[model samples]
Structures are given as C-alpha cells and as structure tokens.
Target: MKRSKKRIIKTIVFEILLIISSLLIFAPILLAIIMSIQPPEFVFSYPPKFLPRGFFVQNYIDAFKIVPFARMILNSALISIFITLGKLFTGSLSGYAYANFSFKGSKITFYVLFATLFIPAEIVLIVPLFRIISRLGWTNTYWAMTIPFLASATNTFLMQQHFKTIPKEFEDAARIDGATPMQYFTKVLLPLSRPIIAGAAIINFTYAWNMYLWPMIVAMEDRMKTVQVAINMIMNAESSNNWGIIMAATVVALLPTLILFFALQDLFVKSLVGSGVKG
Candidate 1:
C-alpha cells in the first residue's frame, strides 16, 4: 500500500511538470497570437494585457501595406520549394551512393561532406562564398540564395541511415529484372524512402523559409528579398513601431511551418524512429 502511494505521488508530480513545461513552451506563441489581434495603440502598454479588450484586424492589414508582404511571401515560397527539392534530390543521391555502392575514395568524399557540418556559416561568409558568388555574377539573384545550399550533410546522413534499413533483396530483384542503376533508384528505392524524404523536406523547407543572414547578404534588391528580410525592414521602419503589426506578421510567418509539420508529423516521426533504430 505504501509503495502504491509513492508511485501515484511520482506520477502526479511528473504530470504537473509536463503541464508546466508545455505552458512554458507555448506561452510566447499564445502571447503573440493575443498581441496580433490587439489594437496598435495598446500593443506596448505596461502591465501587459494577456487578453485584448477588443478585436482589431487592422494590424494584419497595416502589416501588408507597410511591407510588400505578398511579394515576399511568393518569393519565400518559390525559394523554399526549390531549395527543399534540390536538397532532397542531391542529398538522397549522395546518401544512396554511400549506403549501397562501393567506389574509390567514397569514404573520403563522405568525410569531406560531413566535415562541412562542423564549419560555421560565419567562417565561410566573408571570403570564399562571397567571392565565388561575386565571380559567378550571382549576387542579387535567386540562384545565389538557392544554389549554395542545394544539399545538406544532415539530410544525406539521415537518408543514408534510412536507406540501410531497407532490405537489399528489393535492389537485387530490380537488378535481376535488368533495371539500370538509375532506374532502380528512381523507381524502387525512391518510393520506399518516402517517409524519410518527407521528413527531410519539412526540415529543408523550415530552414529555407526562416533563413535570414544569407538572404540579406545575397539579395540586395527589394524585389529579390525574402519574407524574413522584409519583416526586418518593417521592424526597423522609422514611421512607427507597431508591435501588434509585428506580432501579426510573425504569426503569418510561422503558419506555413506549423501547417507543414502538422501534415507530415506522422511520417517525420516514423522516419526519425527508423533512422534511430538503424543508428
């Protein structure tokens, strides 16, 4: 009876801790949503209002007017889509080669790619990357932003690990059917790797969408600037600093990622679990 009471007390403590942790994590997001609906005049009020007195949609409306939000959204969408696709294609190919095929210096190539993960973006920012992009005349272009990050070492590692979990018999069957290597990869392996691909896509999409520094550096023109850059401009605008508008814009920015995760969460979890099992 005493042991049962102790177990029950521990369970209650854990449940309370879990609830507190969740509240802590979600508090900022909840505050942002509330602030987004608040009137601009009351946004910076002291003793902070957790709930707005009245609903005002003008914060969102004003945000669009203050920034070329529509254009920025479109640009962000296009760039993110292309970057995610590029990462998926290139990373998967590299991963497949590493996981299935044996070739001269393959280990060395994999190590080089893995080494890039440790190199901070700041270290590569000033000289090699900028000069290479400048020499190619890619400055202020979409290619400058998209091409450089077309592949990711983490994605490649995830894909390779996932691929290893798949049975070799499938590849052998494809080979017996006289399928070429490319055909086998495209038709057989790619289909089976959907869960991992979806997980990678979510990660790449979020990274490309929220990326700030590189886009700011490469995209010089307002027309070329991404949504994140546009948001920074709005925040720094001299006319007025409307926290409500800023919060509204932030909520808008976060929606895509939230939606993407909700849609692919099951596949993402499955892929991560499968990768973890293999590792």
Candidate 2:
C-alpha cells in the first residue's frame, strides 16, 4: 500500500514538471502572437497589456506597404530552393563515394573535409572566399551566395553514416542485374535513405532562408536583399514605430519555418533517430 502511494506521487510530480516545462517553452511564442494583435498605440504602454482592448488587423496590411515583403519572400524562396537542391545532390554523391569506395588517400581527403567543420566560418570571411569570388566576378550576384555552400561537411557526414548501414549485398545484387553505378545509387541507396535526405533538406533550407551576412555582403541591390536583411531595414525605416506591424512582419517571417516544421516534424524526428541508429 505504501509503495503504491509512492508510485502515485511520483507520477503526479512528473506530470506537473512536464506541464511547467511545456509552458516555459511556449511562453515566448504566445507573447509574440499577442503582441502582434495589440493596438499600435498601446504597444509600449505601461505594464504592457497582454490582451488587446479592441481587435485591429491593419498591422499586417501596413507591414506589406512599408516594405516589398512579397518580393523579398520570392527571392528568399528561390535562393533556398536552389541551395537545398545543390546541397542534396552534391552532399549525397560525396557521401556515397566516401562510404563505399576504396581509393588511395581517400581517408586523408575526407579528413580534410571534416577538418573544415572545426574552422569558424567567421575567420575565413575576409580572405580566400573574397579573393575567389572576386576573381570569378560573382560579386553582387545570386551565384555568389548559392554556390559556395552547395556542399556541406555536416551533410556529407550525415549521409555517409546513413549510407554505411545498407548491406553490401544490396549493391552486389543490383550489379548482378546489370545495374550501373548510377542506377544502383538512384534505385537502391536513395530510396532507402529518404529519411536522411529529408532531414538534410530541412537543415539546408533553413540555413539558406535565414542566411543574412553573406547575402548582405554579396547582394548590392534592394531587390536582391533577403528576408532577414529586409527585416533589419524595416526596423530602421522612419515609420511610427508601430510594434504591431513590426511584430506582424516577424510573425510573417516565422510562418514558413513553422509550416515546414509542422508538416515534417514527425519525419524530422524520425530521421534524426534513424540516422543515429544507422550510424
């Protein structure tokens, strides 16, 4: 009877802790939503009203007028799509080679790629990349932003780990059926590795979408500016400091990521767990 009572107490304590943790995690998002709907005049009011006295949806409309948000969204989307496809194709190919092939100095080559992960990207910002891009005449172009990060060591490592799990016999059987290397990879390996690829796609898309520093440096025109850089411009514009509109823009910025997460969150979690296990 005493042990049963203790078990019940433990369960209740765990449930209480879970609720508290969930609330803490969600508080900021909840606050953002509330602030986005609050009246512009009352944004900085004393004690900061948590609930609006009246409904006003004009903030979202004003945000669009203040900036060409639709154009910025389109630019960001195009860049992200190109970057995702580039990284997926190149990273997967390199990973497959590293996993299955045996060649002289292959280990050393992979080590060098892996070593890049340790080097802070900020440290290389001013020198070799600048010289190379300048020489190629890609400055102030989309290519400058999209081409450099087409393949990532982290993606390669993830794919390599996932690829290593497939039994060698699968490849051998494909070869026996007269399947070429490309055919084998496309049909056998890729199909089996969809989860890892999906995870990599999500990571690549988020990185490209939120990328600011590189785009700011490379894109010289207002039309070329990404969503992040444009958001900074919105903050600096001589508007009436309408917090509702600013918050609404922020909420707009967050929607794609939110939608992507909600749509693929289950797949994302499954991929991470499965990748770790396969590795």
Candidate 3:
C-alpha cells in the first residue's frame, strides 16, 4: 500500500512536469494564433495581451495581397513533394543494396557514406553545388531546389539499418514461393517498411518546406522563390509593423508540417524505435 501510494505520487509529479513543459513549448504557437486574429491596435497595446481581443481575420486576407504568397506556396509544395519522393526512391534502393548485397568494397563504401553524416552541407557543399547548378542552367528553377536534395544520406542510413532488422526467414519464404529478388523486396520488404517510410517522408517534407538560404540564393527571381524565402518580403514591406498579419502568415507557413506530424505521429514514434542502428 505504501509503495502504491509512492508510485501514484511520482506519477502525479511527472504528469505535472509534462504539462508544464508542454505549455512552455506551446506558448509561442498559442501567442501566434491569438495575434493572428487580433487587430493591429490590439497587437501594439501596452502590456501585450496574451488572449484574443477579437477575431479580425483581415490579417489573413491581407497576407495574400501583400505578396505572391499563393505562388510561393505552390512552389514550396511542388519542390517538397518531389524531393521527398526522389529521396525515398533513391534512399530505399541504396539501402536495399547495402542491406542485402555483399560485394568487394561494400563495407568501405558504406563507411564512406556514413562519414558524410558529419559534414555540414551548407558549409562544405554549397559552393561546389551552386557552381554545378549554374553550369547546368538550373538556377532560378525547381530543378535546382529539388535535384540537390533528392538523395539524403541520413535517410539512406536509417533505411539500411531498418532493412537489416528484418528476419531472414521472410526472404527465404519469398524465395521458396518462387518470388524473384525484386518481387520479394517490393512485396515483402516494402510492405513492412511503412513506419520507417512514413517517418522519413515527414522529415524530408519538413526539411524541404523549411529551406530558406539555398532557395533565397539560387532562386533570385521573385516568382521562383519558395514560401519560406518569400516570407522575408512580408517583413520588408510597408505594413511589416502589423504583427497580426505576420503571425497569420507564420501560422500559414507552419500548417502543412504540423498537420503531417499529427497525422503520422504514431508511425513516426515506431520508426524512431525500429530504425535504430543494429549489428
């Protein structure tokens, strides 16, 4: 009875701590939502209000008018979707090869790939990468944004480790059933890889959607800019003082990633646990 009481007390304390942490993390988002619906006067009021003064939605309407935000949204969506798909395709194939095939220099090749994880692309890769893109005449185009990110070493490593965890019996069973290697991979392996795939998709999508610096540099044309890059235009405009409009735009930018995360959070947790490196 004493132990049970202590356990209950501990659980209660932990729950309280979790609630506090959650509120701390969620406070900025709550403030953004409140500000987004408020009037400009309310935003600048002394002792800034934490709660909604009133739901004035003109801020959202004005966000679209202030910039070619709709076009920028379309550009980001297209680039993110294409990059995610491309990464999944390339990462999965490379991961499959590493996990299943044994050949000369296979270990050395995988080690080299693993070594790339430590290199920061923004610092080490950007200059050479931009030069190549420029030479290929891909600057200011979707091709430049999508192509450079089509393959992710991190995704490849995660997938390869996850693939290694699958039991050999599944492969043996597929072979005994007269399935070819490709058929077995598609039918057996991929079907079981949904958790990892979903996790990787969300990560890649969020990364591509949030890209600012590269898009800002490469896509110099206003029409070619991504949503993230275009947000700066809002900040530089005459009405930049309107925190409500800025907050509304910020919330709009966050929507896609937030929605995706909530939708697939379960699978994402499963992937985190299952994709851990294994011998």
Q: lDDT of all the models against the reference?
A: 0.87, 0.84, 0.91
**What TM-score would each prediction reach against the true structure?**
0.90, 0.90, 0.96
lDDT of 3 by residue, 1-279 (tens): 999999999999999999999999999999999999999989999997777866899999999899999999999999999999999999998999899889899999999999999999898999999999999999999999998899988888988888999988898999999999899889999999999999999999999999999999899898999889767888889999998888888999999999999999999998888766453
Which regions of candidate 3 are displaced past 4 Å?
Answer: 276-279
Indicate the residue-level lDDT of 31 in model 1: 91
Residue 125 alpha-carbon offset, candidate 2, angstroms: 3.4
Q: How many residue pairs clash in each candidate?
A: 0, 0, 0
Error of 3 at 258 (Å): 0.8
TM-score of 1: 0.90
Ranking by lDDT: 3, 1, 2
Question: Candidate 1 — which pairs collide?
Answer: none
The TM-score of candidate 3 is 0.96
State, as a TM-score between 0 and 1, how close model 2 is to the true structure.
0.90
Q: Which stretches of candidate 2 lie over 4 Å from their true place?
A: 1-16, 52-55
Worst 10 residues of 2 by lDDT: 122-131
lDDT (tens digit, per residue) of candidate 1 on 79-126 = 999999999998899899999999999899988988878988766655
lDDT of candidate 2 over 154-233, digit per residue (tens): 88887887889888999999999999988999999999887778788888899899988888877778777788877887
Report the candidate with higher TM-score, 1 versus 3: 3
Error of 3 at 177 (Å): 0.9
